[model samples]
Target: MISEREILVLIPAFNEEGRVGEVIRGVRKFLGQSAILVIDDGSSDRTAHVSREEGAIVVSHPFNLGVGTALQTGYKYAVQEGFKYVIQLDADGQHPPEFLPAFTSKLKETEADLIVGSRFLTGSEERMSAIRRTGNKLFARILSFLINEKLTDPTSGYRALKSTVLQFCVQDQYAFDYPDADFLLTIHRSGFRIEEIPFRVDPRLGGTSQHSGLAPLFYSIKMMISLFVIMLRKKSADSN
Candidate 1:
């Protein structure tokens, strides 16, 4: 029963001034009436200004606090503003606005707590670089094994979340760096329903990925350690 008016389109940007405006406009093209908010993650460029110019409500952080924190900010705003649902998109133009309706419809039909637009799902036409693909496969396997559910794209930023999930995201339990497989596992353990749909993602129109270079290796290591810690904590709690 969530209307478009009750849904917020949240775009998190970091030094993506050249691309954020186009993303905003694209979202507006389809869901023109839906409120669009951009979390400018302390971009040194004109990300905030360009987002504002594109007619999106911009919330700029004082400094770069990472993608997870920026997303948390969006969730906080959604909750405070009384939004019933929130759809997230990247500011780099990889996430297509054309699929916004598909997300909305699927959300309504399934009533899923979270709907992920997965590039690896059936019918998706998107392809990744060999290195990125290999990394994604590794993460996907780990997440599937941990959560006991097959997830094709656990790291995808294109997703829609219900108000309950948004509330959870604003709490202390959410991840702060990359809310990927680890975050999904946490949500699953909490008994939230998650579903994924096939969707194609375009190559980045501009800006560099935060996961490029040695960052992926470091991120993978951190995620593995964090997941282990979470499992141990859960086991202890259950034993008590």
Candidate 2:
């Protein structure tokens, strides 16, 4: 059975050698009482060392797994360690640690199974690339329509999930990037509640963006096609 109320912050990092420490420190400040786990997905830099020095529990992957796999590793750790909640944040420093409270607050207010830190709700236009921002908005709107609930930032990487939500996330064959694309379907299929937390994004402290133009375009298309397929399958099953 899943535990209740406890939180474990999960930091999935890749090649964030310079900014990892600051991001971890920022998170530690907000999560003063919460547990933290840093999944170093085969960083080619000192991300692991820096994160450990900053007081985060560092778990290293043998090779660079995709972001999805890194997240799954954290989730597995949370499940094993008996944590009640998990927060997925980037180590690149774009996702401010100060905004963690918004997610925790929404969790309490709505008793939601998943809480996504959304840039739209908080109104950030500073660093968002036009194409990427437009894609996120379009995807969020599409997901909201599909799930029958408003999702402010469907593709936002900053998010929190209740432990019970792990059941859906851990199934074999579950792919990465679901947190951005298939999150609504995963929760809706499992009868879990999802909420959005408004948060203003800050400019990344160091390193270039891991995703931007071509990455966002490809990812959006892949997710949309997958979502449509799932919906069609669901519809056929329902009708049957």
Candidate 3:
């Protein structure tokens, strides 16, 4: 049984000063005193200050690191603090805190090392742009094939991780930039069980997504290359 003391809600924020406070408050409403930590990735804005005002423990970087690094920081904190489970929520309000209980229940029931909140799983319609949707589907299919599992939303950021998998996340084996499909593949290769739960994702409450305009295209291409590289590295390791 996971106690409230053993769980940590980690929110990674970068220039999300307008939305991070709301996200923190929403989580607090449901989580109720469970440790909430905000990783402020060197936001030039007031993200760290707003998060602190909302009563979350804030860890600010000296400069803007990528999302992957910020998330790894949260994982390292969780491990060091002896948290049994870590729930990762985006600072953007796309990931609603209302559905957090579902993640916890699914993780406990399935004993999954990680549980991803997938917007497509429950027929939850979203208003994503065509280019973004195309990139998402293409990458999801690629990752599903590589992992030999049907992953509906490989790019979904809202996820929960057991302590064992959290340990893996902080290690050097994890990805450095975006923790999308490539990171999921790394987790699978490391022998961790990953599952998906149906989730409803709202459009960002405020602030634009990092992957806007040409960014999604670049991100997709980078992730694809990263995925293949990971596959080759794993194969080579297994042969030795």
Candidate 3: 10-residue stretch with minimal lDDT? 231-240
**Tens digit of per-residue lDDT, candidate 2, span 130-183:** 887887788888888888998878777898887678755676645756457575
Candidate 2 lands at a TM-score of: 0.90
Look at candidate 3 and give me any clashing residue pairs: none
Estimate, for each residue in 107-177, the C-alpha lDDT of model 1 and write its tens digit: 88995799998998743433577777777778889888987889988888899999878877888877658
Note the Cα lDDT for every prediction shown: 0.86, 0.79, 0.85
TM-score for every candidate vs. truth?
0.94, 0.90, 0.95
Off by over 4 Å in 2: 1-5, 235-240
Best by TM-score: 3
RMSD of every prediction: 2.7, 3.4, 2.3
Q: Tell me the lDDT of candidate 2.
A: 0.79
42-110 in candidate 3: lDDT tens per residue?
A: 999999999999999999999988899999999999999889899998999989999888877876789
Off-target runs (Cα >4 Å) in candidate 1 are 122-126, 235-240
- After superposition on all CA atoms, how large is the RMSD of candidate 1? 2.7
Q: Arrange candidates, best TM-score first.
A: 3, 1, 2
How many angstroms is residue 181 displaced in model 1 relative to the true structure, after the best TM-score fit?
A: 0.5
